[model samples]
Target: MAEPEDKTRRAPLDAVGRFTATEAVAAALSLIWLVAVAAYSFTAPDGTGPLGIVMTLMMVFLPIALIWVTVTTLRSVQELRAEATRLQSAVESMRNAYVTTQVQPSVQRKLEEIERTAKQAETALATFTSRRDASLVVASADRKAAMAAPARAAPAEDQPALALGTPAEDLRAPLSVGDFIRALQFPESPEDKDGFRALRLALEDRAVAKLIRAAQDVLTLLSQEGIFMDDLKPERARPELWRSFAQGERGRGISGLGGIRDRSSLALTAGRMREDPIFRDAAHHFLRTFDRTFAEFEKTATDAELVDLADTRTARAFMLFGRVAGVFD
Candidate 1:
């Protein structure tokens, strides 16, 4: 079915279209000569002059030449159509062979790996969540008991009272990135596989997505001017110190955003991304793709480990952006 369609699309110009200019002229000449011969044959009384002989010869052979030309042309056209069909079939076969031997297997392997990773993450998340819930329950009960009991004497000056567990927020304190520079100092984490899955679940929350994007936008803007995360030194990682540079603070041996050649400030770059339609659309697309990679992580209950992943991933983004931007030497 497809082969005939391909041949039709690839049909030769001379095979199917109107006759060429030379062919048209020849056909027209033949027709005019035949008409002239017929008129002369009817009017002439005797076949004795040169005109009679010429007319007689033309009338006899002209029809034979026209018939021979038509037959030859029809055969030539049939040959071109057959050749086009064969070429089309060969191309289709080669394309199918390439897809079967190369593209299909590679795509199949990637799909299988993604499926396997998702299952592992799901199982890990469930186990982590159950343990966290049990801890929270125990912590709650102890808190209730302490509150209902009478007040006790204050501890000695050097001693501090210890509880079974600390508050949930305190446990998750490591994820906070109030100072972007401080968050990126460390790159080594053996638990990165576990952490990655935990963070994937955390990104399901819109707030986490917004934070990561903010850091990514900052890095992307800096990269445009050839300035990079790695250009930033460790000292520049502190939130207060970095803000000093961003705010164009003096007394650092440099002027307002002096290191950058574009004369564009970080504040301005950030504002541009925030206001521009193109950038907003790009940010939305990034989050959508990022969310898809860890879609299954969000289905289970929340675990402290998952929350930690969110924190770690956010801080990691800042650290990575800074390093890539050369913010830390």
Candidate 2:
């Protein structure tokens, strides 16, 4: 079945046939007039008054006959022009329909696949994160028990009591695999009670603040790179960063509200992008980068490094972990 847009722009096939018929009739009449004129000139008997008179009379009426033929020809031309206008309008409408609707099905399918893969990746990362967190808790308990053990009563200065373990520093350490997965599963939002306020307080700590900034920067970079590839014109991509920032300022607008509204725009944009060779190439590049960054994060972050993470390097390491888990939020 034709889409509504297609139906709106579709021209009847008989329009062309009608236009051709009009042209053919005009041509045939012109040819017949030419043949009659030629035949009369050759077949008329010399010096025969009746024949000469008849031929003369025919010649006299020729202008009127030509006038009628001219009118018919003009009418055919007008009809042909109207038909051509209709066809052109239909063609333009079809072009719009093709760009807006027909080109999007494949892109929509691919986006759905990406969403599925992202969900699976998030699930796997969540599992790994839970296990890592459990391990940390167990390890901390063991350390506490060892430290709490009694020492033998002995003369002063004979031997020093075993040093007790201090609380593991930086309890809210940089995100681990599990933390990253959690963030992806439940993205941080101001909508959650005290979520934004708590985040701000966390940022007061130099370590957490730096890590948060790094994560934001990484997302910005990825978004910029994607825009760069899609929009070859520097001016077009230049404003993209501002668009992202504006989305944050506006508090998610349509997408942040969590509804189908965002999907409609996304689908439309994806369809347009798919039709653009430059955008498609850029999208593939961005996808590859996403995959590579994930691999690096999964391989490089260790439990020990996650515990005492303090510097920008550690923050970047955590950001990488989050990226791999597809929890850029």
Candidate 3:
């Protein structure tokens, strides 16, 4: 059955509208002319010849035919316009149906997850910048000196121990793997005293500090390309895989460790590696430092600690650069 009429449809006299005033006038005038000519032809003038009769017939049919052609053209145009409207409606319906069927929860979840990560990174950056010149900086310097002093120490006989049996260096216990991992992540906020404390301890370990500084350099370079270590989401490889890479395995043997698969990031990094010699050198140095540090870290670090360390921003940066450099093939 035909659907109920659309009241708003003004389309081309398909259902509701009447013929226009001009069309109606033309049709009425043509019919009047035809009737008048027929009547005049019947009451022919006396002595009229065949020429006059032909002329009468010509006048009778010509105007009517022209008006019929005009009306037919208008109807064709109206039908064309109606067809166009139906085509547009069909397209709109198809688009809405496609959108309804194609959208999925996974894509929405991924976007939401990405947004949350970005917010967290922004918060961490703002917090770190505000506290950059506070007590943290001072403690950092003191820690560096304390760390270096141990290296430049005089003979054991020449230097005296602290009260009781504690050496000056022994006052603080060794930096634990947990603290090292925390330092790699850096302070999340000015109020996170534990984060700050772990960083300070990490700085006091000369080896770890050197690695930290190298990682910092690489991170700074990466930022110029709008890539952030915090934004990277590398696949978490097993601790055994990292240990395998640290033990001098290369190519596919440790390839799983390089989980940074973002094509744009890799392309930008690859371009920089080829064009900038200084950046290339620094990246290589950072990789070496990370490799060495992780080797030592894994020896005493539990599997969970190793995974946490791998997830840190510093380690993420390493994964990005390492993948680009083909360190893990």
Error of 1 at 292 (Å): 40
Please tell me which predicted candidate would have the highest lDDT against the true structure.
3
Q: Which stretches of candidate 1 lie over 4 Å from their true place?
A: 1-31, 43-45, 48-55, 63-71, 78-82, 132-329
Cα lDDT tens digits for candidate 2, 124-171: 554355324333333331122211122545748866665565334334
Task: Give the distance in Å from residue 199's predicted Cα in candidate 2 to where it truly belongs.
Answer: 3.9
Candidate 1: lDDT over CA atoms?
0.45
Ranking the candidates on TM-score from highest down gives 3, 2, 1
lDDT of 1 by residue, 1-329 (tens): 55445544455643547565556666677777778767877897768899978878877577758855885676587767767787888999999998788888899999989966865665466445443334333332112211112245787989877885664533442222222212222232655554454344334334444444555564465466454544432211222332343333434322221233322344444455567766545544443433332232222213332332333333333433322233433
Instruction: Give the winner by TM-score: 2 or 3.
Output: 3
Residue-level lDDT tens digits of model 3 in 1-329:
99997433446454325666657878898989978976876697643799876877678888888887887787677777777887787788899998877776778889999977965565455334432323322223222222222345555996776567655446666666567778898888899998889888888777889988898899889999889876777776766787677667889888888988888899999999999999999999999998887776654444445566778889899899888888886
Indicate the TM-score of model 1.
0.30
Q: Assess the local accuracy of residue 89 in candidate 2 as a C-alpha lDDT between 0 and 100.
A: 78
Provide TM-scores for the models.
Answer: 0.30, 0.33, 0.58
Using lDDT, rank the candidates from best to worst.
3, 1, 2
